[model samples]
Target: MSSSPAALSGGTVANPRSRVILASLIGTTIEFYDFYVYATAAVLVFPHLFFPPGNDATALLASFAVFGAAMVARPLGAIFFGHLGDKRGRKVTLVGALLTMGIATFLIGALPTYHQVGWLAPALLMLMRLAQGFALGGEWSGAALVATENAPAGKRAVYGTFPQLGAPLGFILANGLFLIIAAILPSDDPSRPSQAFLDWGWRIPFLFSIVMVAVGLWVRLNLVESTAFEKTVKAGKVHSLPLVSVFRTHTRQLVLGTFYMLATYVLFYLMTTFSLSYGRAAVNGALPGLGYDYTTFVLMMIIGVVFFGIFTMLSGPWADRWGRRGTLIGVTLAIIAFGLLWVPMLAGGTIGVMAWLILGFSLMGMTFGPMGALLPELFPANVRYTGSGISYNVSSILGAAVAPFIAIALWSWGGGSPFWVGLYLSAMAGLTLIALLMGTETRDVDIEA
Candidate 1:
């Protein structure tokens, strides 16, 4: 490989670019699967298995509160790992993050609940969740930047979408694993599963991360440091204080990127966690047979993940032509339209559920696909990692951290109307729209600092 700055800056798809994209996307997929499994468990099983049994509603909320605890720790993780990524290298930071996330997830599988260990259970559980949060804070932005920077100049948007697809892929695999478990367990209530499910089935999925971690470690270790980072280092131009430099130079970009992602995260948690519970409650109140079971819900998400993946794959080519700003703006507007239809689908039967799943997931694909390239584009090359990571994670905390709680509250307050959740999603999406209109476009900008 050429060592010249020009050679590094003139990236192309014909070389090892595909390999780099694959490495980032697969590693991120594995990491996110490990992360989202905990969120799913929090909503579905952790309250009963781990927490003290008091009021059912309060216990569930407490379980989700623990989920939010990790989001709170993400910003600190971003700063810590962002420093390493900028100064050291993307590969090294990712190596450490993968191990940390894997260990934390593995421990969650082995944990003893309140029945066995008393207060120590929730305490230990929270500690592990925070560790997971911290690791993931660094994982995504690093992966996205690696993929985008490695792509052939003309195909950056498309290559960028590869890493973004990891989100939907992770969701698909996580939910698919849970769906398999649900199907295999003797048909009773999901909350009160057959003895086999409670005895050991739940642990299987969490423990499965060990295999994925091993594979991710193998692939990532074999990969080279990103050419862009190496060029910056050779130029002696790497920011000594990336976090400070990022804020000072790119505050507006940071703010806009944060808003851009806010609604995406919010709607994501709502679709996966709160909707399941709300749908169940609605069925219980109305027609018992009309409610979607755990298996059905997971299956719907799988379908949505497929569409999300497809649309994300399509985003790159589109961005190269229409530009990242226009693509993102179009997607953002579509999301609001999707939100308007969310309630009718929830209140309706099987047809309605299918309609919402297809529409929402498709819209998710459109926004998320362009976001990988767009967010990193906001900052100059020197502090790209830190600025993008901080914006993404902070927005995650604001939009996603409390999404389930907010959606549930809305659903309950609105007397089971999914409309309120839609309204909440719209408001969050509206913020992104305003930010988009106000922010600068970077699609045609050069990557070199």
Candidate 2:
């Protein structure tokens, strides 16, 4: 109940290291669970439920546009919450972000379909997606600060990675839940015996966020504030306007960090969202698709996501040993190679599809793992939250916000060839490689300095 920052910062946790790590991991997992469930639904259900009758391709594009709206909102969320996290404390901002994201996700589930509410349906969907993005803008940077700031000397990369694990774990849970519901619910085809999945089955996954949000809040409420932020408060060094300080003092770090993340965000949406849409459409129809069945593609994705989780864990220790910059550079090169192989590998049928997912995700893990520590380490403690959050979210706008839409457009431009998409990804990786080379090594830096 104290208004003093020091009192609030030190309110909980006797063992800050491990408890903070666990708390960060739990909060991020839940946040991303809410985030990713919408992503899956955008591809699987939103086109039918929210968009008016039109070309399936145009309908699908409309759904993805709504999905991208969240990414556009993310930077604004970052600016707002980042200031609070820097001035107040990481714990306070994180809790507020979780509540915002949870409420938005729950409302998204309860929204009426186009048939029921007409244009109001898509409009409401866009608003909710914007809310989700805004909340997520603060979530990742806060989690990274929590884990990295409390980490043992020389182990920040490994500790930071604990929060990064949430992405894969959230992906697995979101997809697994959808997979279960998809199995239980009837196919989209009315000709099938039971109810169509698009009609109501997809809502189950979105509504399920209510339970996960409760669990995340329980764990996060017990977390003590990050030690680095606590030290800043005790020293009376907290910025009154942290966003101004971030832009004034850390502009170069912000730019480099944002570009460093370009490849990871682009590849993520490409693998999960674009691939889902690509695989499920009819190959011989007016729109070109791979002609894969829905259930089979989801199952394959679940298997691939499991590997994403595994390598996400492994990437921590790997980055600790290999150096974050070195690990990212090596992995970015591999992503470039993988980008070139996308058409050939995917063209190989089911086995090839599996290979593509495994290879892409494995590389993604290696690169994404170090980002938690890397971005936070880029700036001093005074501006860590704001700098990292803005960098990460801005990259989302450039990379993920338009990735699927771009991929779809490129595919259409290429006459169904994936070459252009592959080229796009490879180009992003090239930019990331340049960013890595321009940045300094931070694994040995003092976080509180």
Candidate 3:
């Protein structure tokens, strides 16, 4: 008795394993590269270039406000793109999201600064930032589905990691480029970017998106739709309104999936955005920091993110073996521990900070990796795109969108101690742990069913 429903649906050639992996991986790499490029600049360049000259804290806060605003646009984009992905197909949706992000990023590169265009500078920047967020809202879930839907029996989690791998790769590439540019345009002072870097060098990464997006579009356009979605189409299971269908049928999973991803998002922004701010802020300022120069701190982040990539790849097999829920449970516990311990680590000076970074990023990877399969597994094929995108992006609003802003507030509250920030991370991880405890093991779930 043949039990391969995908095969029984019709005689269709399976998506080439390499193609599925590469398409999903490359698309997200480009998406995240665009995002992190903006993120790095929000910290390094935007405060000076976009906002009018003023109090440093107010300027930095304004920059972060624009940065967080993008997270608000994410769920909206998810709704639009999810509708398209579920109704049309993942391949076209992926290409559309990539184009959206690429164009926004490239345009941001060309935009005039506050000095050049006054209020229009920040307005244009916020508009492009929203577009980037919207594009990403649809990008991740589609890519995750591509990997998991194309996966062979018992290997969905492993295949799912392909998209997750993009986060670290994109972070490295984005920050690495900034570091190189900072080096090329050396500053008169050791602690800050050179005047040239401030003026024009930062735009290079944003402008470079055009080239990367071209490559992503090429790979994604070549992809055949995943068999699971193909089967959904043939069976006429595609919902006219996938968002309505998901909310009506999969409401419980939607809630669980959102909280389940909470800690991961919190840790991610804390480790990247908040850390860079904390690490480089002057030691004697109103909000005291470690006083490391900007270049040194970014270099440290690149080192930690290397571990993030390694563990992200490792999480696939681990989740495949132990199941997504179980693997995440363990990782979540570790995140809680790391959150509590990071205070001392930050105080331990450079080596301690590095240890804190490695530990934090490792936990980030382990927690972040499994969700590529875990979230999609929460719903059946017909609603997978919509359900996953909604859960993922809504959680972005709750977690990622507010994390940096909240962390900054907490940091200031504690007199730049970072104690409150670490505690805040622990608390979010606690919520995620509870959600994991409530979730079912999805490793063996028939996603196509």
TM-score of each: 0.94, 0.95, 0.97
Candidate 1, residue 172: how far the Cα is off, in Å: 1.8
The per-residue C-alpha lDDT of model 1 at residue 343 equals: 64
- 2 or 3: which has the higher TM-score? 3
Q: Give the Cα error of residue 255 in candidate 2, in Å.
A: 0.1
Candidates ranked, most accurate by lDDT first: 3, 2, 1
lDDT of 1 by residue, 197-295 (tens): 766788888999989999888877766777678678878989889998988888888998999898778877876677667655535553122366667
Candidate 3's C-alpha runs over 4 A off are 1-9
Each candidate: RMSD: 3.1, 3.4, 2.8
Predicted model with the maximum TM-score: 3
Cα deviation in Å at residue 369, candidate 2? 0.6
Better of 1 and 2 by lDDT: 2
Better of 1 and 3 by TM-score: 3
| Model 1 ranges off by over 4 Å | 1-15, 285-290
Task: Give the per-residue lDDT digits (tens) of candidate 2, residues 265-326.
Answer: 99999988998877776787555778777778877887887777778778888878878898
The backbone clash count of each candidate, in order, is 3, 0, 0
Alpha carbon lDDT at 137, candidate 3: 97
lDDT of 3 by residue, 23-88 (tens): 889999999999999999999899989998977889899999999999999999999999999999
Top lDDT: which candidate number? Answer: 3
